[model samples]
Every structure is written in C-alpha cells, then in structure tokens.
Target: MTPVDTVDLWVIPLDRPGDETRTAPHLDCRESARADGLAPPRRGRFVVARGATREILSGYTGVEPKGLVWRVGQWGKPYVELRQDTAPVPAFNLSHCGAVAVLAVLRNGRREVGADIERVVGGRAERLVERFFHPDEARYVRGFAPAGREAEATRLWTRKEAYAKASGHRLLDVLHMPVLAPRPGRRPGRGDGTDTGAVRRLRDVPFDDGWAVSVAVMGSADFDVAPRLWPEGP
Candidate 1:
C-alpha cells in the first residue's frame, strides 16, 4: 500500500473485451444481485465496475476480491468493512461514465477520497448550469468560448461530483458548492457550503480521449494523485 500523502487513481475501461468474463467470478452475492438487476450493456458495465473495484482493492488488502465485505452508508456510499486488526484500510470512491470507470483509493490510512468521470457531451451543460451549479461556477462555464463551454461545464461537473462523493453527501445537497478558485488569490473550499469540517482538495486527472476526470481528497494537506491503468502492476 502507498502512503496517505498519495491517492491512487485507477482508470478502468468498462467495455473492454473479455473483462466481464474474467472479473465476474469475483462478485459477492450482493454485487451479483445488483448486477443481475441491471439491463444489458448497463449490466455488463456494472459487473466490470464492481468486479474491478474488488480486484483493485484486493491488491492493497491481501483479501481475495470476492472476500472483501462492504457496508453501505446512510447516504448510499459503499465502505469496505475491514477488520479492526487490519493494518491499512484504504478509503475509496468510484465513478463511471460512458465506457470508462475511475477509482480513487487513499491508502495506508483512512482518508476520504472521491473520483468522477464524464464523457464530454454538448448541450446538457447550459440547463444544468442554470439549475444545479453555483452562480460563480455557472459564470465560469459561461465565460468559456462558445465552443469550449461543454468541456468546461464537464470539468466543473466532475469537480462538484467528486466533492459530493468525498464528503459523503448527495449531489443535490452539495450542488451549490462552488468548486472553482473564484479569483486569483482565493482557494475553492471555504464559504462553498461545505458543512463537513474536513478541508477538501480538488484536481483534474488526465486520462484518455472523450472523457473528463477529476478527484477530490479531504484533508488539511494536499495529496498527490497517482493515476494508472487498471489490470496493470503497481
């Protein structure tokens, strides 16, 4: 496991050929039931996402992927229920969009982390900005060139999403949270409606084409985000 100062980000391709066949065997009964509830394409994606989550967590915990137990929070976030004797129980969060899934793990200790990925699509941003985004963030997206609005909106959306997940709050509840560094000297967190006392750090994660990714970590100090492709070694 890595140090708490670094958050490991794993990029997983949900539609990769043969991934489902290989990872399906590791799903617990609950995960299997959830996967079974989904329709095609989505079902396949769910299987790949959860299965890969197990495989990735297994690397750090030494627990077989299927053996890892999960508990759900009141807000619907999933937590890995490790033994009290376990030396390092990593905090993690996962998000997926289109064909890609991203997982963030803060290893060697419990530190809240969240990740979000979204396909860059046009036209959806304008209305979402009007309804969900904080005024400052909406202005930021609108300030972008007409052609750049969608990408900027996607970036802002991912940041808001990552922050929500990191704080274990619902998206709608935190939709008013401003994620941008509003002015030159100002940082993004305080006065952004964060009721949680933990300080939040947000950053954009570089990944493959057609996707925008971002990660959020809650701590007083900043943490480096180490990104890597899934099914690959440390």
Candidate 2:
C-alpha cells in the first residue's frame, strides 16, 4: 500500500462579525463585493469566503495574503500564481453556501484538489439528483429509503461537484463519472472506480449543523483528508 498524502481543510463560519476582519487585510473585499452584485446577504458571504481563503493560504505560504497573485482557469477555477523562484505551488479550492465556507488545500508534489459544501435544504435533493446525477448515481440515491434520500443525495452531489472541481472539468462533462456507493458500515473510497490518474481519491468532510462537504484529490490511492474548524479571531 502507498502512503496517502494528507489534505488540510478549513471550515470557517461566515456569520460572525470578526470573520471579515480576520482576512480582510489580505483580500480585495470591496472589489469582490462590487463584482458580486448580489444582495447584501449573499455579498457578505462572498466576502467572508474570499477573505478567509487568503488568510488560510497566507498561513501556509508565509506570504502576505494581499500579496498573493491568482489566475482563473478557462473553466473558472481559481489557482494561486507561482513565481519562478517561489517554492512549489499548493493546490486549493473553496466553496461557500449559506453561512459557512469550506477550503481544501493540498501541498503534496501531486497537488490537485477540489472541495464543495452545501447546506441541507428540504424538497430539492431528489429533484437535483434526478436532473444532474449520472444514471447510476440517481438510481443509487433513489435506492435509499425515502426518509434518508435527501441526505444521501446531498452527499452524492457534493462528491460529484468536488470531483469535477478537482478534475478541472465542467460539471456536465463529469456527471457521467461513477461514484462509489457508501458502504454499509464503512466510509466511501476516494475514487469511484473510474480512476484514470486524474481523480483517485475522495473524502467526505464531517461537519455539524446540517452542512456537508466533500473533497477530491488527484494522486495515488494513498491520500488522507483531514478536516479542521478555523478558529474565530478577535
């Protein structure tokens, strides 16, 4: 068995006042706010997520958050820019919904990561699974008892989205990719048995308060996912 590289994840709550201040100095919150054009509530969440991303990455890179450079891929994935003289660039992804944000970072030599989080909402999980999930995934979700369908659907959605992000492929392009079914008494495997060297592992992040997070990494089967709650700053 190969040694699994560990992935570091940070779950930050955006509802607190000081959340913005903690990472505000490291990101252009005002510009992001303007570009968002969303109503106040949504805009506020965006600011917190963006700010927290910078702060978290800064801690890992030892660079001022505001000094970090980023570029967006053709598929709209954001990545840190690396200078020729800088150390190896880390792989990271961020997702936010409702009042929480999730950030996943992988610094191993095979750095590639994607993560997503979604708040559980009633009455939409089945519909979403029907419309967006692969045929097998949809069937698997439907196979769950009616009372358990929503949570299972949410898990599948997050897993699929995370894999898509990690692969840098459009969500539609990867919908057909199969996902491993959750074992009766065990955790789901990282890969959904479709490992072609791009996405070889998956880890479901554990959180409280009805939110689900999933992370996908591009590497060998020996990789571990570690989740941490970001502390509230003064």
Computed on alpha carbons, the lDDT of every model, listed in order, comes to 0.82, 0.75
Which candidate tops lDDT?
Answer: 1
Cα lDDT of candidate 2 equals 0.75
Per-model TM values vs. the true structure: 0.90, 0.87
Count of clashing pairs, candidate 1:
0
Q: In model 1, which regions exceed 4 Å deviation?
A: 1-4, 182-193
Off by over 4 Å in 2: 29-36, 182-185, 190-197, 232-234
Per-prediction RMSD in angstroms?
A: 2.9, 2.7
| Backbone clashes under 3 angstroms, per model | 0, 4
